[model samples]
Target: MIRLIWTLSAHTRYYLRRYMPTNRLLDEIRRRRNLKWGIPAMLLAVPYLLIASICTNALDQGAPGWLHLVVLWSVWNAMKLIIMGPVSLLLLVRARIAEAVARRGGRRDSDAGESVNHAGAEPLLHR
Candidate 1:
């Protein structure tokens, strides 16, 4: 059992390392992007939350309003998990691609001896 658990853990770690952002800053940006999506998601849920609260309170008079609230909360959390995971992942992948492109462009520019700051202009030589 321990061996199996260890193997699974190692595999999961490897997978995450391969797929997730390698740089610390990029990882942080991914987390912040998730939070940015999450905060507005919770804000948008306010109306449904109010509805659930009303239902729960109304059930105090003797009904099953708690059921509605339970379902609402469950679905809301599930949807958030489902939606945010891919969106944040997409952002991280995009950042990685952009970084790769910039690195490639930087190498090409340096090799060609050109500065993007001055396009098609004469080279400046200091004596």
Candidate 2:
């Protein structure tokens, strides 16, 4: 029961975080506003869920001997999802931070170059 509740809570939080406005902020900061990382993630997740479902169904029944092989596979995939959820979120956050730092550094470098140019320019009166 506790495990079920934790699973539900984690899933809920994952969905909620995806829809939050902060996701947009992160995307903008990361310069990946146009990149769709979700596509591949969903592609991988769909096959995983389908295989898991089939394996679970087979296990619940007295299936052919060879089908038993999938029991562990399904369980492993389920556990992978449980663990990947937080790791993916952390990766997204890290990517966003890296993007922001790169952007800031670029801007600072440009500003410094401009300042140097201005200081090197001779005054009209001096000319």
Candidate 3:
């Protein structure tokens, strides 16, 4: 019974987190192909920061203490997005470099094979 309760609670938490506004927004951004959308996604942090600012202002204006949670959540989401942008850019650069290297390597290998075949050598397949 205890194990079942724990499992259910874990599942509930996962679904809750998955559907959170910030997570949903990030999921949408990452759904695009090739991580190309990530560059623009960096701009999303601005709205989160603005939300935090607004909540903070509300708190100062004698709003409910619950607004503190909103401010913290907004700031956390903003920081996540800010950090994701630079990390995604680095990943994109690394991918491009690897692709370029692979292309050059493939071409060099093909050229070397052609030269060997033209040097009057028996084809490896027939041998």
Better of 1 and 2 by TM-score: 2
| Model 3 per-residue lDDT at 53 | 93
Q: Weakest 10 consecutive residues, lDDT, candidate 1?
A: 20-29
**Clashes per model (N, Cα, C within 3 A):** 0, 0, 0
Candidate 2 residue lDDT tens string, 56-124:
787678677666666565555545544554555666677789989999999999998779769887646
TM-score (C-alpha, index-matched) for candidate 3: 0.73
The segments of candidate 1 whose C-alpha lies over 4 angstroms from its true place after superposition are 1-63, 114-126
Better of 2 and 3 by TM-score: 3
Ranking by TM-score: 3, 2, 1
lDDT of 3 at 16: 66
Compare the candidates by TM-score and give the number of the best one.
3
Between candidates 1 and 3, the one scoring higher on TM-score is: 3
Model 3: per-residue lDDT, tens digit, 6-73? 99999998996698876676666554354676767778889989999999999999999999998998
Flag regions of model 3 displaced more than 4 Å: 1-13, 24-32, 121-127
